[model samples]
Target: MPMRLFNIVYITILCLFSTFVIGQTLEILPPKNITTVQVFNPQKNDNTAIIRLGSNEYLLFLFDDLEAGYKRYNYKIEHRNADWSESNIFESEYVVGLNNDYVRTYKNSFNTYKKFTNYQIQFPNKDMNVKLGGNYLLKVYTTNEDQPIFTKRFAVYQGNVDVGMKSSRYINPTYKDINQRIQTVISSGSQNLTETPDGGKLFIMKNNNWNEHIADINPDFTRSNQLTYNNVEWTFEGGGEYNWFDTKNLDVPGLTTERNFRKDSVYHTVLRVDFPKYNLPYDDYGDVNGNFYIRNNRFGNEYLAASEADYSWVYFALDAFEDQNGLYEPYVVGAFNNWEISPQSKLKYNPVSKLWENEYFLKQGYYNYQYVVVNTKNKRVEPSYVSGSFWQTENLYQGLFYYRPWGGRYDILMGYGEVNTRN
Candidate 1:
């Protein structure tokens, strides 16, 4: 194993074990009732992004080469509910594919012969597929094509991490036996290694990236035997004292992040949104992500969510927001939006708003999210998530991660941060 590979495995194990996604291939499964066509992978561009949420893994992918388009391009995920299949987003409850809500379909494509990326969309609900943490296949079909197209089976894993980490190295008659019980995880736990109680040392191997995050190393404490052997880098997640090397690693509070930079600064308009409880029937009457969105175009005391781990979504209705001519679709823009806007992540129009609105599910951390409109052709866009509203509401945020090392049990670690209006 290479050092980086060990780091990834260690960190992967330290973070969480997802047996479902590990090394699983995408394949075509059947027993179905939908029209199909020629489906295959070019071996190279068969790119896929698998996400593990809770106990389930969601795959977001795109496919290409459609001869034509249709009024309704309905797709279905076919699978069976068995005795050991764990759980399904829809299973063992009632009839399958009962309605559109359980299924996600795209109607009327702007389909063209031009090269398009992110062309595939799949919502592999637990029913159409099993959550057994293994590899499965995907079959593609079209209202136009005839035979079901076969795909390479991709792996979906549900592996988690180990916990039970206590102190390491105890040499003495009193706490020697006691220390061994904490997590005598290493292959070697001989007494010769322990020179003294405080001097005696024990070690825990963490995956690369599985780091000393949130908590910093105690300055007064020193680190020995911190080196690499074989392909693995053996070090500590950090310890000694409590708050030694702590200055908010990875992410600070009230901050935002994005993969693409669509614009410069995303406008965030904070609102006093009351999620209709009893008397209310819908959302965003004053909702930002709502259809009947209150159109405010300013910034506010917008600090962070009450919880530190909230990256807000920016929703805006599109009503001639811009010229509908471009390679990119306009989605609500914000710092989370990465500033760029066009078609890939654009918002759909809502008749109720009499405008168009887009929604984004942000990372569970801090930062202001705002409404942004973009023109893919000109590449011009505007953001305003922070705007006008009589009601003032701010958000505080927190982050928590659970993980276990490979071959060992696991535990959960909760980290907190405060991201206000400050950078």
Candidate 2:
């Protein structure tokens, strides 16, 4: 090839690589001052950020900034493919109105030792409305510098197809006792999924954890307008039920709280020490399936909890023998931290106390969490290593079906369904 032609191709490849890198790294970093970020449907009072396409309902995004004062923050919405990657379609093709807008609603904390400001915004507002039904990313940033502080993922579905899900523990012998398999069937009605060059894709998620999900799953067979997915790969660890703690009332110690006290003009809470359940028999204590909710029991009105609740430095300690050898690192995982294993969630071993301890500044609420071990050599996270896997453990499984024609620019969310293992 000519020198000029070679140079042009090289530059094009470099630009494409740069764009891909930026897209991949955008969701990893979040500002340190941001805390308790939540996106959910207010009407349902749950943490799942899913809504029906063209419905009157909306998802509310809420967060607290430790900076304690008002700051100008803007949010931009971007449509994503079924794999959570940037779609090729333009913003106008997926968004009905403005793609970006300022967050106009905020409130200051009242009667709290730690002063902070809470910010919230509702989707499908006056300035912006999503036109497409698929995966979406909400990017929150500072308006002045255009610097992104955090990003969240949500979904909208047309419900054009019906999805049926069944979860069982009768997998192969190797995983039959420790894994739960999800079998799904999608009814496409008059739509023929096989007509497209690439048929529909299925994604399964456990307990609404986006970071750990099974994606790009194809159907095993299709017939009579029905697609089935019963592959052996559709299995997840049946990790034990989450450990919980309640801090809805600072004056009174909750079930899992060892004690609550005040020091240095601030509040602190010590949770009861936790232990590894790998050797213990399965216990069926009902839980919220690794989810959390903010509430102040002292206040009669539940709505006031958002602004009136106080912050406390909650201490967590683990008395596990597996991590004593230092082969693995232990970190507390839950919805409170967006289910991401970060430095904030890592626990440090105390030589004198012989325990792994960490403290988190959290608002008054009820939280569900579990201890996870990270292999030092391979960096593999094992949820069942400390929590103990059980075939009888209850779990929530969700499935999403996406379809796109051969020439379509983006994937369409055709069906969504969820099932509880023992419900």
**Candidate 1 lDDT over residue span 178-273, tens digit each:** 111112221122222122223222222221111111221111222232111111122221111100011111232122122222223332322222
Per-residue lDDT of candidate 2, residues 74-95 (tens digit): 9898788887778878887989
Task: Name the top TM-score candidate.
Answer: 2
Each candidate structure's count of clashing pairs: 89, 0
Residue 167 Cα positional deviation in candidate 2, in Å, after optimal superposition? 0.9
lDDT of each: 0.26, 0.79
Instruction: Estimate TM-scores for all models.
Output: 0.23, 0.92
Please give the range of 10 consecutive residues that has the lowest summed lDDT in model 2: 1-10
lDDT of 1 at 321: 46
Runs in model 1 with CA error above 4 Å? 1-48, 53-57, 71-104, 107-120, 125-129, 142-147, 162-423
Candidate 2 deviant stretches above 4 angstroms: 1-23, 144-146, 171-173, 300-302
Candidate 2, residue 283: lDDT: 93
Error of 2 at 387 (Å): 0.6
